[model samples]
Target: MTIDEQQASVAVIGLGKIGLTLAAVFATNGYYIFGADKNKEVVASINQGKSHINNEPGLDQLVSDAVENNQMRATSDNVEAVAHSSIIVVIVPVLVDTANQIDYQMIDAVVEDIAKGIKKGSLVIFETTLPPGDTKNRFGKRIEERSGLRLGTDFYLAYSPERVYSNRIIEDLEKYPKVVGGINEKSLLLASTFYKQALNCQLIEVSSIETAEFSKVAECVYRDVNIALANELAQFADQTGVNISEVIVASNSQPYSHIHSPGIGVGGHCIPIYPYFFINKGLNQGLTPLAREVNDGMAAYAISQVKKEVGSLANRNVLILGLSYRENVKEPTKSTTLLLIDQLLNMNANVFVNDPLFSDREIHAFGVTPLSLQDKSISKIDIIILQAYHDDYKNLNFKDFTNCKLLFDGRNQLKQEDIKKHGITYQSIGQQSEKGEW
Candidate 1:
């Protein structure tokens, strides 16, 4: 089939954050979208015009309109998705194991299911982040073996990484330039043409599938290293009574310098885990592992700083403000808040957690006592740690914590002077502490 005669039907394999957003985008662009997931509840929710994942701006209304207009539908049947669509986009997650290796089981299973119904003239594109050489070797080989078809001749295969933030997925998908690489020339042309028609954004075509795979991982590693540098500098600033935030702002004013902020630690699915995709591939890069170590150890380091200020955490009431990795998203994948809570409990501190994105049941499910922001018990807390910079807590009334002694801003979410004006001892990630009476 030629590019001019290609069908407008598209299939998205996963129904998580990225997958659902992609399905919605395609539906909005006048394509028939078949959104597939293994979870029956997720499929049912989408079919009913309700979003399973919450807190994403404008996603709910877009999904509702798609379902109402008969442009999008969700199902658990993989064969049904492949049989109906000419273009199949796989956006399933590729996770890393505890041994710092890419776990191939999830992607392998997804490919096996796709092979059952992939047609001869279809285009298969993977948007999952992967180590180099996995797409051309492992994924292409599995689909060919199952379907008994040639890759370049029978069908097209390509890899395009999903470069999007959780809260701003739709905007990023439309605004950012998309990178695509394929197994062959024909495959690259087909994938690029399809995305250009759907998204109408700038499309960058690279040489091979490995290049595209490594491009996304390389972007994450770049941020991880820069963040590790800022975090290491914050440790030094804390010991010497220096303000690291001020130094970073001044340094970034120069044209040659671009530094990220230092936080309690890096979190979310990308920054904390993407380095391991290259480290376990037998590369001789030492700085990658070192950066991971520094970022990973930041949670414990934050606990030590709290102990230094409060003398001891034994029997003290500690409240953590946010549980999700970032603000306004309900994703806790590899979040540093989990690590913070673990160490605080080990130090014999009474831990309480609160996040407006989550309910009391969800907070308690993480194995901590849940507290509402409006609860009167917050006034009696000994220390309050702000783990995420959620907008709900940004303009909070600091006077509510009447009995609180120390306020630790893990994300630098509040101003030191404003917090101190309430007569509470305020501490931040990379700021010099002022000696004053609370």
Candidate 2:
């Protein structure tokens, strides 16, 4: 029987940002998509020809077109999706607990459901960022025991880590080289061929599934280490009265010298979380752990700079712009603002936060009063912390700060002269205070 009689061309289990994008891309490639999501609202939204993720560029139109053309459909049942598709792509998240321990509960549950519904001769490709050997050692083995299926015999399993950034996933999919490795030669060959034709882009087929897993973690760890080094250099620059930003520009002119910009902290789901995977390997845990420690301490470093510049924080009106981890994105996973709020509140400082992306209720959820951009809301007095630097602050005139003493540009995105021209001292990572800078 043809695909229409029994199964779909592809099944995408998970309709989150990455998963939905993959489904839409697959649909655009002429493969009928069967999307499975536990969140009923997400499934309903997709079925109604709409995209739940609003921030991803060009996603809504893609989703609408896919659904409109009857090429894509979503369901709440994972088993139903798997049973109706010949090729299954799983792209679920593996979260970490408060103790920084990998919580495999969610992934474990999804794997079990896949094992229950995975069909004979169907290929299951995981697109999640997992620890090395999880697909082969744990998941593949478990599927064998639970489903009575033999790898490379009854079914095929492969690991292809998702390597795309938020807000640019669709573009990155076409630009970045897709990495794929499988439990065996046959699985690897199958996944590689499928991706080479489907993505119509560069493909890197590694030796083993474990290698594919390590590649993703290694990428994240390398970035974390680079960022941590920049933060350390920023600290040294502050002590030595050197401009870290200036140093980075001059140093990077060598081409071989690639120095990252220093920020308040590395606060994202990937960089901060994946370093623990590299460290937990229990081998030569050298720079990975150290980098994580340094990046995690940067939030406190920002607050320490504020304390040094303005002295007493008690009863001080401190406004924090952008509560999200970074600019433009609404995701607050492991945000630096959380750390800042804790320290500022402990110092008895009146904390006010604002992110154009987040609602007032969400801002209040952080235990800080929401600061609107209006002049009445701009009644901020003592300190202003530019945490995430959203585009809303781009044309913002500095004169709006009625009695602001210091403008701490956490990301170094703002023009220093503009703040200084308005009589407000500007401070940022790696730079001395505005008046104190050389």
Candidate 3:
């Protein structure tokens, strides 16, 4: 079948941020999209021309326009979506637990649904990040077994990792190069053709499906190790009265150095999780796991600084600023603030949380009291840790924190003298400076 024949309809099996964005982009580009998800509310919302994710730029309008134009629609039945469309794109999430093992419960169920209805000559592309060869060995085998069709012959299969940042999926899809690979030449050709025809993206075709899967993990592992190195150097800089942020800038002035900034911890869906994917593969487990250990240890280090400045943390009231992993995004997956909260609670400190993105009720779900910075009625706050540097927090008056004795700059974002000007002891990772400047 030709590319035009396959474009009769396309199935996007996962209506999450990345998946929904993919469906909208395809529909906008003049292709019919059948977006499938297990969540009935999400499907119903999409069918009503609504985008569930509010923060993603251009997604709401695109999805609305697509549904209005009869280009894309959503359903809960993956089997129906697969049977109706010739091109199937799977973006189901695969997460790792505390044991560093892949939890295939969600993705496995989606695969079972796909295998039951996947048609011959239909191209199946997995865009979820996976351990290097699991696309072929684990999921591909399952599909072949359930469908009774041979890969690279009866049907085509490919792997293309979804390399997108949350809240910027539409922009990243247009800008970043899409790395793609397949089980065979035919699979690669069809998947490449579909992408080229569907989206305005530059494609980097690789040698094999395993390479494409490995590329995404390697990209994230590089960041994880780089951040770990910065965290280690920050500790050394703290002892030697040198600011690690300045060190990072001076070292990176030359094009050769590209050091990542040290923080309270490395959080986010990609950086904190991908290293474990590599380590669990049993391929050179030395530095990767060690890096995870170093990054995760930063929360304890921050609390130790609190202990140094304000005596014991027991019975002290600690207010954490920023719950999301990153400053601006609403996502809270693997947030470092959660780690700090855990440490503070273990030290018997009463924890209060504040983030402009999350509501008071949502903050309470994390088992912490929400302290609005805008609240006029002043309350006792012993310590304030700046985990996320949201713009709304830029004008934070230390006077508001009169009872607060310490202002810990977890992201190295706050000014030191200003913090000290209010008699609040300022501290951050490796931020030992008489004159505090970046």
Candidate 4:
């Protein structure tokens, strides 16, 4: 089909934060987007113009507009989404195992389902992060075998990884440059054309889908390794009684080598896991071991710092401020915030959590009761752990936590003076403090 003659029907599988944002973007750009999810409740919520996951800003209104304009439809059945669309985008999660091994089972399952109903001439794009050969070996081959059609000639396949941050989904989607690669030139041209139509940023084309996959992994790996470096520096500084946050600020003034500031731990779905994927690949192929150790050690390091800061963990009323991996988004999947909470609870600490985005149902699932900032019962909490740095917590009054003396700022969410003025003992990774009373 000619570029302009191509139909604008796009099917987005896996309607999580990334998938829903992608579907919303395409639908806003005038594509008829059909979103499919296995969870019936998620599908029902989307159909009603409600978002079960709170990541993208103005999503309910966007989904509502899409539904009313007949540009978007959601369904629990994969067959319906696949049958209605000329392009299929897979945005599922590909998680790492306990041993830090890559698991492509979710990607394989989605590919198999899409293969059964995927049209001959439709385009297939895998936005999920995977190792080198999954796109060509696992997904492309399975679809070709199931449909009995050539990959490049009969159908198009590509990998265009999602890059938008959970905090700024809509803004980042429009601003972030997308990297796309396909098995052949025709597939590349067509996929590039499709993405350029919706996205305002530049579209970079690479040689193969593996290169595209590596590019996505490379972006995340850089962040992970840098974060690991920051974590390492923080650990070293704590031992030497040096204020590492001030060191980072002074060192970053060089302009050429700006390092990432340290936090309690690296939380979030992509950063902590993406480097592990590359590390796993390297170890399988007999490579260096430094990257894996540094990144993996960081999470434990942050938790250890929390323990050290709190002094005594036994029977302390610890209030974890944020549950989501990062700020502004309501997603706790693969978050280190929860990991720290679990560790604290295992040590028999009384953990009360609060997240503006999460519901009481989710809080109960973690065996903890949710508390609002205005809750009267939390006035006597012992420790306040600032895990995720949401906007709401940034400017919070000192009087709110007046009863609490120990504050662990995981994300450096609070100003230096604010913590000091409140007469609270505060400690954050890599950050320095002014000379004041504790």
lDDT for each residue of candidate 3 in 190-298, tens digit (9 for 90 to 100) = 8898888778799999999999999999999888889999999999998888978889999999999999999999887788888778888785567789899999999
Measured against the true structure, the TM-scores of the candidates, in listed sequence, are 0.96, 0.96, 0.96, 0.90
Could you tell me how far off, in angstroms, the CA of residue 38 lies in candidate 2 after the best superposition?
Answer: 1.3
lDDT of 4: 0.79
Candidate 2 has which clashing residue pairs, if any? 8-84
Backbone clashes for every candidate come to 0, 1, 0, 1
Question: lDDT for each of the candidates?
Answer: 0.88, 0.87, 0.88, 0.79
lDDT of 1 at 111: 94
Error of 4 at 319 (Å): 1.8
Q: Local error of candidate 1 at 149, Å? A: 0.9
Candidate with maximal lDDT: 3
Error of 2 at 214 (Å): 0.3
Q: Which ten residues in a row have the lowest lDDT in candidate 2?
A: 1-10
User: Which segments of candidate 4 are over 4 A away from where they belong?
Assistant: 1-4, 50-55, 284-292, 295-310, 400-403, 432-438
lDDT of 4 by residue, 313-369 (tens): 788888888888878877776676767777887888888899987887898788887
Error of 4 at 243 (Å): 3.3
